[model samples]
Target chain A: MNNDYYSKSYMPGIIKWGKITMLLGITLCFLPALVISFVYGYMPPAAAILTGLLSQVSVSGAFYIVEPISYFPILGIPGTYLTFLSGNTSNMRVPCSSVAQEAADVEFGTEQGSIISTIGIAVSVMVGLVILTVGAVGGNAIVGMMPAGMKEALNYLLPALFGAVFGQFAISRPKLAAVAAVIAIGMTWLLRNGFLDFMPGKNPPSYLVILIAVFGSIFAGRLIYKKELQVPEEEKTEAK
Target chain B: METGKKYLEMANSPLMWIAAGIAVFVVLMQSVIFFRKSLKAAPEVGLTKKQVKMAIQSSAISSIGPSIVILVTMISLLVTMGAPVSWMRLSFIGSVNYEAMAAGFGAQAMGTDLQHLTPIAFSCGLWTMILGSLGWLIFTLLFADKMNKVNHLLSKGNERMVPIISAGAMLGAFANLAAGNFFTETNSLTIGSAPSLACVFGCGIMMVLTKVAKTKNIQWLKEWSFAIAMFSGMFVGYLAR
Candidate 1:
C-alpha cells in the first residue's frame, strides 16, 4: 500500500536517541584536532586573545563558523566540498533523500515486513558511510594535483561570471543595464586606472567615483521610470 | 639526528588532519541539509533539477581553478628553487598563524639545543599547510559561485525578479576579495594600512543602492533586503574572521 498522508514523525525514543547520539558522536570526534594542535601549537591563549579583536566583518561564508581565518566568511565544509570535489564524497545526496522517503513511506504504525526491507536502511547507510570514507581519503590525492594560480591571470572569473548573469539584465532592461554597467564600470575603471594611481591597490574611497556612478544611474533610472519597476504579474498574485 | 627529528614530527600534532576531518564532516552535514532538493525536483526557487545539476557541476569545475593554482604554485615553487619538495616551506594564506607553528619549533629547538631545526618532514604543520591552501582556495571559489548563482537562479527562474537579487552577490564577492588585502596588510608592513574595509563596504553599498533606487519602490525594498542581508552575512563572517 502506498503511504500518502504526511504528518509528524512517530519514531520511537530509542530511534530518536540513536540519531542524537550519532550526531553527538560526530561532534565529539572533532576534539582530536584541538588536542593535537595544542601539542604542535594550537595556542588557545593566543587565539582567545586575538579572536576577540578580529572577529566579524568578513564577506565570505561567514555563516558556518564563529570565526574563520581572514574575516572573509568560510562556509565550513559543505561549501568546501562543493568547491573542491565536484560532488560530496558521501552520496549524501541520494541516501539522505532515501532516508527521508523511508520515513515518509513508513506507515505510522506499520513496518516494511520483509527482512531485506527491514534491514535495508541500516545496511545501506553502513555501506554508504564506508564508501564515503574511502572516497574522502582518495579524492584528496587527486585534487592535490589541480592548479590554483590560474585565478590571478584569470581574474575575470567574477566579471565573466557576472557578465553572463548581467547579460540578462542587458537583454531585459537594456537601457538600465547599460547605464548601471557604464557607471559602475567607468568609475571603477577611472578609479582603478585614473588619478587613483596616487593611492595603491587600485582602490579608491567610493564617496568620490563609484558612489557617483552607482547612485547616479539609480537616481537617473528612478526619474525616468517615476519610482515604479516593471514587476512580473505572477509575484503580484502571490503577494495578494 | 635532525632527519630523525623531522621524521617523528607527525606525533607532535595531528590537528591539521583533524581539522580537515572536522571540516569535511561539517560540510557533509550541511550538504545533507541544503541539497534537500525537491522530491520530483521540479524546481523550487526557480531552479530546474537540470539547471541545479549544471550549477553544481560548473561550481565544482570553477573551484578546481584555485585548487590547481595552490598545488602548482607549491610544486612550481619547489622546482623553480631547484630544491627538493622536502626542503620547501609553504606560506599558508589567510590564516597568518604560521608564526606560532614556528614558535613551537623554536621551543623544540631550544630543548634540542638548536642543534636540530629540522621539523618532521610529514608533520602536522606540513599537513596544515596543505589543508589551509586547499581550504582557502575551495572556500574562496564556492563562496563566489554561490553568490553568483543566486542571481543567475533568480534571473533564469524568473526574469523580472532578477534585479531584486541583483548587485548584492557581486558586491559581496568584491567585498571578500577586498578582505584579502586586509589580511595581507595585517601580515606585512608595520605602519598604517590603507582603509581597505571602508572601500569594500562603500563599493558594496554603492552596488546595492544603484540597483535599489532604480526599481519600483516595493521592488527596491526587496533588493535592498538582499544587500543588507549580504552585509549582515559579511558581518557574520568578519566576526568569525
Candidate 2:
C-alpha cells in the first residue's frame, strides 16, 4: 500500500512483459519478409536493403525518439507499452487515452490516470483490430459501396478529431491552452515558411517541430502556474 | 512475371496469414493482459469499476471513426502488398503514409515502383518496412521503463506539478497537430476557407457540448461530446469544400 509500491512492484513486471512482447512483435513483423525471400529464391541484395533503409530511416528515425518522449507525460507506463506496440500514437492513442482520463475524472500523471489510460488504450486497440479485420475480410466491397462525398468527409475527420481533443483539454485550462495553441501554430507557420529549416542540408522534420512545441508549452505552463498563483506551499501540494 | 505472381501468392498464402495471425494475436494478448492488470489495480488506485468500464466504453466508441480510416488504408495496401503483409504492417507501427512510403522506398531501392512489384523489389521493400519500425521498437523497449524519470525530473518531486506538466504536454502536442490541420496556405480566409474550418467547428461544438453537459448534468453528452464534435466538424469541412 505504500506510494511507490505500484512503481516498484507493478511497473517492473509490466516493463518485463513489455520488452518480451515488443521484441516478439518486432520479430513477427519480419516474418513476412523472411518468408517472401525464401519462397522467391531471391534474397534482396544487402545494398538494396540498405538503400531502402537509408531513404526511409533518415526521415522517420527521429520520430522514434521524439514521439516516445513527447508522448510519455500523457501516456504513462502501461499505456506507453501498449500504445507503442498497437501503433496510432497521435491520431488514436493520445486522444483515446486523454478522453478516458477525463471521463474517469482522474488527474493526469497519477496512478489512477495511468490505469484509466491503459484501459482506454487497450479497448481502442481491440476495437481498431476488429474494424481493420472487418475491412480486410470485406476488402473493396465495403469501401466501394460508400459514396464519394462521405469518403471525402472521412478524410477530413482527423483535423476535426484533433480540434475536439484540443478543445476537450483547453476548456479546463484556457490560458495554458491558448499558449499551447499559439506556440503550435506559430512554430508550424515558421516550419512552413522555412524559418526553422536551419539544418545544413536537411529540412527540419515535423516531429522536431512537435517536440519543440511540447517542451516550449511545458516551460510556459510551468511559468504561468508558478507566477500566476502565489499560494502557500501546502496549497500547491494538492496531489489528488 | 511468374515469379512476381508466385510471390504475391505466397505473400497471401496460409503460412503468411498464419504468421500475421500470430503476430496480431500477440498484440491482442498484450492489450488483454494490460487491461486485466489495470482492472486489478484500479481499486487500489482509487478508481471504481464503473469508472473503468465507462472509460473502456468511451474509448471504444472514440476508436470507431479513426479505425475506419485505418481500415480504408488497409484495403488500399492489401491490393498491392497482399493481405498478410498489409495486415501485419498496418497493425504494426507505421501509418498508411509511412507504410506506403517505406514500401515504395523498398521498391525504389531496386529501381522500381510498387505498381508491379517484382520478387526482389518486394523483398527489399519488406526489409525496408521491417527496418523502418525497429527504431521505435528498440527505443521503447530500452527506454520505456526509464521514462518515469521524465515525470520526476519535470515535477521536481512535487506531486501537484505532475498533472500540470502532463496537461501542458498533452495540450502542446495536440495543439501542434490541430494547428497544422486548421491553418494552411489559402488565398482568402472565410468560414469555409481552409481545413481550419474543421478545427473551428470541432472546438466550437465541444465547447457548446461541455457547457450543456455541465448545466444539464447530462453525463452521456459529456461522454459522446468528442464523437459529436468530430462528426460535426467533418460535416462542416465537407460542406465547406
Highest-TM-score candidate: 2
Q: What is the lDDT of every predicted structure here?
A: 0.31, 0.81
Q: After superposition, which runs of candidate 1 have C-alpha atoms over 4 Å from their true positions? A: A1-33, A41-44, A47-174, A177-240, B1-15, B39-162, B165-241
Models 1 onward score TM values of: 0.38, 0.93
- Give the least accurate 10-residue stretch of model 1 chain B, judged by summed lDDT: B79-88
Report the lDDT of model 1 for residue B60.
32
lDDT of 1 by residue, A86-169 (tens): 222111211121122122222111122111111222222233333334433343443354344322332322222222223322
Candidate 2: global Cα-lDDT?
0.81
In Å, residue A15's CA in model 1 sits off its true spot by: 22
Once all C-alphas are superposed, what RMSD does model 2 give against the true structure? 2.7
Question: Which ranges of candidate 2 are over 4 A from the true structure?
Answer: A1-5, A200-204, A228-230, A233-240, B1-6, B183-191, B211-217
